[model samples]
Target: MLLRLLLLICAPLCEPTVVFLRASPSQPIEGNSMTLTCKIQHAPLKSDAQFCFFKDGQTLGQGWNSFPEFQIATMWKENSGSYWCGAKTASSKAIWSQSIQIDVQRVPVSNVSLEIQPPGGHVMEGEKLILVCLVAGGTGDITFFWYKGALGLNLETKTRRSLTAKFEIPTVTESDAEQYYCAADNGYGPSLSGLVRITVRIPVSRPVLTLRAPRAQAVVGDVVELHCEAQRGSPPILYKFYHEDVTLGSSSASSGGGVSFNLSLTAEHSGNYSCEANNGLGAQRSEVVPLNITVPTEDRKELLTSGVIEGLLGILCPTTIALLFCCWLKRKIGRRSARDPPRSAPSPVPQQPTYLNSPDPVQQQPIYQNVNVVSGDEVYSLVYQMQQELQSAVVEPPRTRNEDKDPSAIYSWLKKANDTDLDYEDAM
Candidate 1:
């Protein structure tokens, strides 16, 4: 009993066995790696010893294994605490190593990257754009900077403890479509990220259509030009023209601008016209414009005047000729009667007189029946021969002075010629 007591009393002073945990890096920086080793001071069989690690009284692994060391691939501020290890051997009970307090220090920011939300990195106009500045390794408080183009255009500056920082744009515009960059600083110099291109696409706006002609008024056979333009849009715009809902033609502009299409006017082309502008996103149409083809009133008036003049000449020419021929026939008849005076037969009482063509048994033939077939000279010759015969046959009859001077004897003949017994004559 005294020998066992003496051995126990000498064990602590002579061969003191001290179990402790050793850290390769005494002060580990956040986002760095470290290793912990558990060992015994007087241990001679370390390979047979199994060890397990703990931080702030919480086990790091499932349990004890053959390994006597613990490793941490990454370190953070949350892992800064008092750490210890437990060692167990096949022939002894579990033993706890001395605990050590570790402090994780803050590190400078590095490996900065700028990422755009809604992946593929294209954001249209008026949409929200998010720029996230992230650091692969950093610690403690850090300040993030967002910029566009150069440093003169600093978009935002924020200080936080997170490894990532965000800058949001509620509404993106054309000015925001330039190159972007992000930077991070944690007491050291700023770590700037590479340039990232952020393009803000703009959709096509409503188009405006205009019709141009050589004159103020459009007419048939005029070549009219149709101009379609959108106030704002991206490049490579296509323009299409429509007349009365029918497609006329189309044109394209590689750069953002207007386009024109030529149209020939006709009578059938009078109607509403419109144009459409498309940039692949969608098509926008312009307000309808009306086209009217006109025929001048002066031309129609001239044609009407000429037609009226021709129609009047057709009717009046024939009537004018007929009037002139009647006047000539009347004058010729008066001349014939003036040359031959009427003779009257002496009555049996000798005081009464007879006025007739001839006071003879021979009858005078009507001249009107042969007026169209015979000439005026032939008619006069026949009348003169008959008058000579009549005079020779009835020489006892002669005209009185008052009958030769009668003014009513030369008008025209209206009485029947067969009633020649009455010594009456018809005036020429």
Candidate 2:
């Protein structure tokens, strides 16, 4: 039993036992201190023993101790290689512990920067602008976000060394031009950039005005139209039309700028006219225009018979005088002819039956012969009847001899028997 106890004591003196070794802060930052230790497995030997640390087979340092420990000061980033601990005795060589690796990390970035680029001197109403954000140095996933007027507007994430985000404000109005800011996140936390105020400004261009009339000329008591227009201006601009230094009417531009007003025109309405346009910035006045109106006289009317009355008078007076003179001369000549007597031949009875034994005055006178037409039953019957009469006269011997000797006496006797018929025939 004395011999076994002696063996145990002698064995510890010859070689030392190391149970566990440890390193604080498994993960560490660059340029910071750290510690490494080697612990004995059993109660340390009363006789002094040595402990050491090594890296890739190179010895770091040696010391005598109960348990050996390493104090690394100014542990630079280069000290991040593999390392281990060992325990040694005077009687034997050193024994190494299990190897351990160290890590060095970078700090998260803070206080980012922001830059803005607007389209003009100032952001115009209804105009667009852009904002950019930047950071110093950080790794792994990161997020970017933008804000306007305390409201989150955009957010994004990236794995690259640098990140970018874009913002668009369409149809920027007065309300849109406000304070804006941006921030970055690395999952550890978020850091904010600074904020800036935006202002909007615009100038009103030239305005155009127009006029309209009910007719080419505004006559008395006629209704006329007046109008105003602008060649270039923002919509919803209020327009006021004026005439002769008086306001005619006011209207707002809906699309293309134009407005009209109606007025009952009179002779007094003839004058100059103008208009003004405003969009809350300023008002612009148009050039002056002049107008004049006149009234017309009524048309003349004519009578129905005015043309023919003079012509009728000129024709009738000469015709009446000529007809009266002709009738008066004709009556005078007839009266004169009746008053004058004609030279007549003397009667044969008035001359005495002288110079011979004139048997009788009536017998001495010229005998008148007469012829009479007789009617008959057929065309030659008249001839036949006259022949019969002649034969009868011949057969009566006394009448035949008497007619042959005194044919004039017979003719005279026939004329005297039909005197009215003989006188009528003589007048024809």
Candidate 3:
């Protein structure tokens, strides 16, 4: 105690006035608070004395302040460097302190996040897709992994010093749309991000239209259907049918496919037909299809006349054929009879005269001739087969010499005046 009191008087002359730089924590973790100080080694400085701090030959942003220390509220990896301090008085030359070194260790990664470019994860097909995995709080070299859904479905992995890693698809298709996430590790446990869903939109291609009818031809009153389809469009597609540029009808496919529109055909329905398909992006039209509708003719009067004419023809045709056949048969029989005489029956038989010829025209009675039908002939023949009828009630007189010699004398008066000769007909 007596030695310490004696040295106090000579302390100022013996020791030099120098400055020292010190740190609150020589090694600080990233994002932690830290502080640096400029200390005078010997006697106290004047009230007007100023101090400054530096890092690696560069000023630590505070220039000549009455305060002798610098404070770092948060430290980072980039803040690690050599540090020093300096001091000066209004009446004396400036002085500096020896440099000190501080290292701010990097914190382990946490809070991983997955994001998509053209945000919302809504992408069009055939376009590029970018997936970015971010580290909210991490330092040093970090390893990032992108997952579609679970860790088993790993999409990509990258190790670098960057805060974020990216996975890019040059051309995305429908199969690429799904849920995704990311995991980050910086010498620490892996941290997973929330799920991000991707939806792919496919633009409607050119549609195809088809017309189907119940019959071979599309006539009036026929029920036909128009089929419209877009081979590569997304869901809830709207289909519209047109005829000669006029809207006919519309239909939709909520689950994505083809649709049909039924049409009751009429005379006015005949025209060029087409169809269009849309899924909110844009509409596409199909090629024009020509349609023709035919209407039946109306002719009640002509139909009735034709029916009557057909009925008459149907009835008269057979009758005409029968008449012609009969006429031909008659001609054939007449020719046959003329060519060959009949063998079954005699030509004529002699008979007593039924009436005598009178000179007065009014007194003459009509003479009836008997007709016989020959089997092979067609014309009427005068046959005297009624000899028994003529002799039924007539009184008979004994034959005289002249009656015996000329039996045909009884028919003399019925003959013409030029016939003077008479001959007897032999009985067959």
Candidate 4:
């Protein structure tokens, strides 16, 4: 009892200057070799001081040794424990080193898998997406990395001693569409997971249908084209053209934009035309476009014949009226000529006798006695014969000026003859 008390009291005075335990590798894989060292700072380098190793408060070996190191050739899971060392001298109390815990882990990770929170990997744009990375058949703390195609995404690393790790994407967009994968590393190496494909679907917008024809009016036997498109839609869109709600034709735009269809127009094709665009999301129809087909005027024989008849009548009616007018004018002229006889040259006026001796000398006029009077029937026959001569002269293109004399002269001569006849009757 007295010796124990003295040892305890002197233990502090002769304690080693510094003592600590260190392992070559703080973490070691299973089946690897490692060395644990116990160092004493105050002891001589070649001192023969005996050292003893302890594991979890138990002695590892039966006795002490001059060396201050412990080696493990083949580490195992069971070899993980807290270890320390103690130094003893013949005249000093024993000194203990600080404790250190060693951990033996399994081999590096060999497999990694990624799974989406919502199965099938189909997600809407602007929605959150969760990805979970799983490590298979590995031990130790692991680091997980997320990747999109060949590019690395900005995701927080997971450094946990667990079999599964999670990575979250706040929002997804059209630009995020690509193949994704993950990797698991445990200091030894990294293992990549299988690729997962993601798709982003877009809804179809209102479609617009436009009609193109060779002329302002669609006619029979003319070719017409219909184009359909959407302002926004996904690729591989199916377009269907409709005429009066009947499907005329269909087309597809593989790269997305627009599609067109052609038709040989007929009379039956005149109706309200529209189109529909679909891309698996939904179908959208465009506003109705009116198409009118006209028939050519030459196609109907009855109408053509009636038009011809009306056109001939329109020409011949005016021509017939003009012909009757010319004939009436010619007959009126012939009758007027027959009533009036042509006037003979005016007779010379009688000359007044000049008498130089008297201021007032009486002028003497010559007096005619027996003038042969023409009968009315003879006058009518002479006027008719003169009219026949005038008509014959008009038929000949070239005539003298005398033959073309004014008809007014003939009228005056007739009046004079009537007056003279009245005077002669009075005288008788």
- RMSD per model, one decimal: 15.2, 26.5, 18.5, 18.4
What's the TM for model 3?
0.50
Candidates, ranked, TM-score: 3, 1, 4, 2
Worst 10 residues of 2 by lDDT: 378-387
> How many clashing residue pairs appear in each of the predictions shown?
4, 0, 0, 0
TM-score between model 2 and native? 0.35
Candidate with better TM-score, 3 vs 4: 3
lDDT score at residue 239, model 4, on the 0-100 scale: 96
Q: Supply candidate 1's per-residue lDDT for 34.
A: 90
Write candidate 4's Cα lDDT for 138-186 as tens digits.
6667888888875666456778777799988788778777788998987
Better of 1 and 4 by lDDT: 1
lDDT of prediction 2: 0.59
Model 3, C-alpha of 181: deviation from truth (Å) = 1.3
Tens digits of per-residue lDDT for model 2, 238-340: 8887887798888887654577777787656778888887776788888887877664432111122433555665786687688667656654553454344
**What's the ranking of the predictions by lDDT, best on top?**
3, 1, 4, 2
Which residue pairs show collisions in model 2?
none
Could you say which candidate leads in TM-score?
A: 3
